[model samples]
Target: MDKHTIMQYFEWYLPADSQHWKRLAEDAEHLSQIGIGMVWMPPAFKATGLNDVGYGIYDLYDLGEFDQKGTIPTKYGTKDDYLEAIQALKQHGIRPIADIVLNHKAGGDELETFQVRKMNPTNRQEALSEPYEIQGWTGFTFPGRQKQYSDFNWHWYHFDGLDYDALHEETGIYQIVGDNKGWADQNQVDTENGNYDYLMFDDIDFKHPDVVAHLKEWAQWFLETTGVTGFRLDAVKHISEDFMADFIAYAKTLQPELYAFGEFWKDDIDTTLRYLDGTNYQYDLVDVGLHMNLYQASQNGADYDLTTIFDGSLVQIKPQSSVTFVENHDTQAGQALQSKVEDWFKPIAYGLILLRQEGLPCVFYGDYYGIEGDFAQPSFQEDLDKLLYLRQHYVYGQQTDYFDHPNCIAWTQSGDEEHPQSLAVVLSNSEAGWKRLDMGTLNAGKTFVDYLGRCADKIVIEEDGWASFPVQGGSISAWIEESI
Candidate 1:
C-alpha cells in the first residue's frame, strides 16, 4: 500500500463531454492537496462511440487518436488530451492507473460469417446448437487507426465467440468450438450459471496465443505512450487466471512497481481469494464483501452486528492487498447493479473504510461529488474529506479494536512516535453511546476533540489514560488528541 489513497477517476454516467480529461488534469493539484495519492482513470482507448463510457472498447491502439466511431476523442478526451492529463497528474505527484479492459471487446468493423455453437444459458458446457455458419460482428479492421501502433489485426480468428447474430437479429451465447477454439474454461469461475465469463460483446479468447501476444504488446505500448504507472483491469473473471498472471509478469518488465488490481466482483470472499491464489497473488482485489456488509448495515441499522463488519471481507483476511471502498459506479443509484448504501449510513461506512488502517481505501468519484443521473444522490464529501485528512496527517499508530458490542464498536490507536496524536474511533448503528477506553499511558491528561462535530464537546483523559467518548445515534465519531 505505497499509495494509501486512490480515487476511481470516473463514474458510470460521467458526462459525455470531451473535456473530462481537461478538468481532471486541472484538478490534479487540488486532489493531491486533499490526500489523493493516485487516480484510477477510465479506459483511455477509443471505445465503440463517444458515449460508450470507455468500456465497449474497439481499438486498443486508438486512444481517441483517429476519426474512429465518428469522434476524434473517446468520452473523456483525445489522445493528446489524455496524455496531457496523465502528465498533469504526474506533475502533481499522482500516479495515473489506466483501466485495462482485456476481458472482451465490442463494436466490430463489420459482421463476418463464422462457425459457432450456442451454449446453454444455465450450463455453458451443454451445447444446444450444432456448429454452423452465422454472420457475427467479429471483424475489427480498425480502418481509422490504420494499424498505426501495431500491425496486428483482429478478425473472427482472433476471438473465440460472438453473442449476437446481426443477420438473424438474435442474441445467444455462442462458443467457437473446435480442436482448441472455444470460451475459456468456465470451471475457474464461481457462479450458478456454471461460469460468468461471457459478460458482454465479443469475449476475447485468452487461450489463443495471438490474442495474448497482442495484449502484451499493447500493454507495453500503452505504458510507453501514456506513461501510466498502474492498471485497473476490467471483467477479469472472464479471462483466464493464468493469462492475468502472465500479463502482470510481462507488464512488470516495463513497470516493476506497477500497482494493478482486477474487478473480480464476487458475492463471497472465497471466490475472490481463489482467483488471487490462481493468479499467484499477482495483484489485489476490490473488497466487495465489505461493501455488501455496509449495504446490509445500512438496511438493518441497529439490527446488524457491528462486530461482524469485517467478517468474510478481504481487508480482514489480507489487509494489505484489499482495496476497500464504500460505493462505486456500479453500486450508485440506478446503475446496472444498484445496491446503494443508505445516505444516513454513508458517513459511517466511509469512516470505517478510512479510519481503520487495513486496506487501501478508494473514494468513489460519485460519492465525493454528488452522483449525476436520473436520480441524484447527496454527496458525503465533507465527512469523507475530514476522515481522509486524518488519514494523511494524524492516522498513525498501533490499532486496538473493541468489537464486543453488537450495535456499537470502538477502537483506539496508540500514537506513533512520528505523530504524537492518537485516534479513538467509535460508531453505532443504533443510538447514542459512550466508550470509556484507555488510549495508552502516553496521553494521561490530553484532551480529545471529535472532528465529526457529533459530540460537540471535548473530553479530557484521566490520570490512568481512560476517557469517556460519546457519539450520536446512527453516527460515527473520530476523536483526535487535540493539538496541544
Candidate 2:
C-alpha cells in the first residue's frame, strides 16, 4: 500500500496574482505523480481584500462568487476556478482539504454602536472598564453577496468581542456586553493571555444559538458545495472546544469519513492531548511539539541530542492522531509563529517524517517550491523529491530503531510480501558517522547503495544481512537495494 502523504499547497508570501487556483489545477497531475495523496488548499472564502491570504475572512458565502472584498476574484481565483481546481484534484485521485477559519470575522460591512467593556490584554478575563457605548464594525451584511447562499446577517449580538472601536478611533480588546456573552471558559481555550478565546477581529460567540446555527449551516453548505474530502481547521485553541466537537460531529454526519485536523499551535503535548480529549478525538492535531523539536534541533545543530528528537512529541505518544510537519505557513519566516527549521536541517526533518511509519507527514509548499517575499528562501525541491520518491517506492515493512547515539541515528524496514524493497536510513547531526544496522536476515549478501547519492561507496551486506551505512555530517541517507 502506498503511504499517505499530505502537501500544504500554499505559503504566506505567495504572489497576489489570483492564479493560485489555476496553478494548483495545472499541477494536479504532477502532484499526484509525486505521491501526494492529499492537498490542503488555502481558504476559498473571500477575505479582507486581494492580498489578505484568506485569514481575515469577510464573507463565507462569497467564495470569489460575488464582488465583495473589493474584488470579484479572491487572492486565488473565482468560485468557478476554485470548483474546477477541486474537480481536477479529485480526478487525479488527490483528496482536497479546505482551510476553515471560524474563530473570528473581519471586513464587516458597517459600524454598529454597542455596549462593551475594555478587557486587559494580558488577562482577558479582567474587565478594565465599565460598559460603555462604542461603534464597532460588527455588522456583516455582506451586501455584495445580496443574500445569495444564506441571508444570515451578522450583528453585534452574534459576536463576543472586537479589537477596534471605530467610534473612538482607538484600539483595545473590547469585550461586547450582553447576557451570556463573554470569552469561552478558561478550561475551554488555551491558557495564554489569561483566556485565549479572544484572538483577533470579531470573535464569534459560540455560546450564542444564532451564531452556532449559522456556522453549522455554513459548514454543511461548504462541504456540499466544494466536495472537499477534508478540512484544516485554523486557530482551534482559541475556539470553544464544545462547539468544535459539536461542529465536527455534525460534519461527520454529512461525510462519515471526513478527514479533519486542527492547528492547535501549542507546543505542550499535554495541552494538545487535553484538546484532543476535549473534542472527543473528533479530529487529529498538528504535532506542534515535534515541529518545535525540529526547529530547536536545527538551531542548536550538533549540540542538540538527536536521540531525544521525538521526546515529548504528540507523534511519540499518539501517532495515529498526529499530523506531522516540519514547517508550515504560520511557522515560515516573518509570520507570527516563525520557528522555522533551518535550511540545512530540512532534509533531516523531512527524512524523520517522510521515511517514518508513524504520523501522517505533510510537506510545506514554501519548503518545496521556495518562499517568494521579503523573507525569501531557496527551495529544497531536489532533496524533497528524492525523499518523497523513496517514501513512495522503497519504504516498507517492520521497522527497527537504532537511536542509541546522541548525534547519529539509524533505522531499517524489513521487506514485506507485496513490497520487497527494503530500506535503511541513517542521519548525523555532528560529524560523519556510519551505523552497522541489520536490514533483515532474508537474502543476505546483497549489495546496497545510498539512493540520495550523497555517499559514493557501496556496502555489501554480510551473511547476517548487516551492513554499515555511512552519512555525511548534518545530512541524511536512505540506503536501498541496488536495482538489477
- TM-score winner among the candidates? 2
Residue by residue across 269-305, what tens digits does model 2's lDDT show?
A: 8888888999999999999999999999999999999
lDDT of 2 at 66: 88
Worst 10 residues of 1 by lDDT: 183-192
Candidate 2's TM-score reads 0.99
RMSD to native, candidate 1: 1.4
TM-score of each: 0.97, 0.99
Per-candidate alpha-carbon RMSD to the true structure: 1.4, 0.9
- The global C-alpha lDDT for each of the candidates, from Candidate 1 onward, is 0.85, 0.92
* Residue-level lDDT tens digits of model 1 in 1-484: 2237999988888889898999899999989888899899988888889998888888899888899988998999988899999999999889899999887788898888878898898877778988877788888888887878888877787777678977788899888766688666765555547667677888887888888888888888889888999999887787788888999989999998898988888868888888888998899998989999999999999999999999999999988779998888788877776889999999999888888789999999988988766868877788877988878866677889889899989998776767668889999999899888888777888899998888888899989889888989999999987773
Angstrom error of the Cα, residue 354, model 2: value is: 0.2
Model 2 off-target regions past 4 Å? Answer: none
